[model samples]
Target: KFAAELGRGDKVRFAGSTADLKISEVLSDAHAIADDDPDLETLPSSEHALPSEPATFDVMKRVDQKVVYEKVLDELASGGTLGIFPEGGSHDRTDLLPLKVGVALIAYSALEKDGLAVPIVPVGLNYMRGHRFRGRAIVEFGAPTYVNPDTLDSYKRGGADRRKACNDLLEEIEDAMRSVIVSVPDYEALQLVHTARRLFQKSPNVDARDKQDMSRRFAEAYKQLVARAGTDPPQKWLDLQERLLAYRRELSDLGIRDNQVPGLDRERRHAEAGNYDGDDVLGGGRLLYHIVHLVWVLCLAAIPALFLNIPVGILARVYSDRRRRKALAASKVKIHGRDVVLSE
Candidate 1:
């Protein structure tokens, strides 16, 4: 439907579990070892039990996957575009899940089939609380990567070199995806990053998309810190989280938001520009500002929230919450599956 609207309907062919044939889904999430590289070695897989797929997925896995594989190859062979999730499943984690190796195999197979390089473009669908109403998302696109000619040549050698080629290509794909994603240790860390972003913001007008770069950096740094600290994080990090959470909670309790905090703009300028001449604390001016701010918020945010809740907001939330829980339960990798529900 979207393809037709986008005017690429003729050029795109979508694959699916049962409605269509996706080689990866048909293989029961198996790594595509059976594809032509006779030397491809089977690696240990699924350290944790994977989520249960729909009944159709189980039934589809029993069918020969070669036909679907051929269809994918034929699509590529004929210069058609192919879009795949690469993970072969939906996930809600802050970090990138382990990519299913099927995508790499498909690329390799397509290259070997016709001696043509297949381009893999990594796309990141980053969202801010995607399950919520009016949640925001950013579609970030990375540079297109192609299977290395050397890797293809090595794959043709049909030995351990073949396995190395496959592994190398898979690693490359993962790296490309990682380059465009904002990955943190967990949801708690993500929220902390958001709070920090809000406090450090130069202007209250900054939206989620505008802060994505800062958020990405914070996520990367925090993850690295967590990795270095091991089981227990540094006390300073914990203290910072505690303080930030407390500040945010206080803002929530008052009818004031982070943006509306008294002297927030003044402090932001002082901190960034190193100007300390002006007083950070406002007395009566602050009270007057907040009084006006509170009324404005009620007229804008609160009223709409109440109106939306009455019709679709609460009901959609209830259904989405239940679906999120179910998705989280069945999946090995998904942390919350909130994004999955929104996408669904």
Candidate 2:
């Protein structure tokens, strides 16, 4: 449906050039061999699975390289958009994966065939508590990128120069993506970086986009500092890290988010509303009414939360864990696969 909308009236097909058919090899001769092989040993065999349905290849002929390649070029030539994840596959990593060359191939191919430089805009998909229900997201678009004409000329020359052109174009795409992406070294550092951002944030109502920009800047600087510091960071940074860590821990334990600290929230709200005086206070009756309202809301929230969480939570855990451990070797999601779970 989304693809149909994007393509207007045209039928939109899966973008892959080919699909491999493989079957599992459950009867390995030796348990030792299974254990010794990488990715938990039981990877699918190269043998093609039996085609249970008629005209399988005919049905799947859309995957032909030339056909798909021409289809992409047609889309570009028609002024229709093509969205490609240059990573080739999804993962839960805190950093960008090495980009596949396919993006460059498409770009270069289009430029060569049509003599037009298609503008590729980099988009960052930043998530807060991704893989959870009601999680927040911040999308940022970087500047439009054009394939270098010089590189296109090299590709036109053909041979080894073409390979280098694709690679060079891929590097340019990566740099463009990196400009908008909010990347961190690891999930643990991600938590700390966010906590530090919250700790130093001057305004309570800074929008998510600006917050994402701040996080990117902070994560980059922090990552650089850690690399330079090696095993031993400067004492000042260590102390700051410790303080932020403890503060975050306290916040978590109290079920209080950084923006929801008790006294600070009220003052901030009042300040935002332009009603704060040096020593003004909320009335006792109003406070009592708010406290009761909070309890009632909490009670209402707990009922639905408990009912919704149980079955879905367990299923999400099992599925995510299996995918992270058995299916995805490149996944960097934690033990629980919190970042990759689709159940959320």
Each prediction's RMSD to truth: 10.5, 11.9
Give Cα distance to truth, residue 238, candidate 1, Å.
2.9
Worst 10 residues of 1 by lDDT: 9-18
Off by over 4 Å in 1: 1-63, 203-210, 262-318
- Candidate 1 C-alpha lDDT tens digits along 1-344: 22112221111112221112223212233322122322122321232222365221222223355888999998888889888897767767776655655787788888888876888999888876777757877898788889987777788887678777877887788888887878776787788888887778787676655677787777788778877988988899889889999987888888687767757767687689965443444655788899999999878877867886677867777787888888776654565667667755
Q: After superposition, how far is residue 82 of candidate 1 from its true place, in Å?
A: 1.6
Q: Model 2, 1-344: lDDT tens per residue? A: 12212211221112221222212222332211111212112222212222444332212122336888899999999989999987756666677755656788888888889887999899998886777668887789999888888777788888678777776677678788988987777778898888888777888789877888888889889989998999989999999889888898888898877777857777788779987554455575678889999999999989988898888878877777776565344332233455556643
By TM-score, how accurate is candidate 1? 0.65
Which residue pairs does candidate 2 place in steric collision? none
Once model 2 is optimally superposed onto the true structure by TM-score, how far is the C-alpha of residue 88 displaced, in angstroms? Answer: 1.0
Clashes of each: 0, 0
State the weakest 10-residue window (summed lDDT) of model 2. 31-40
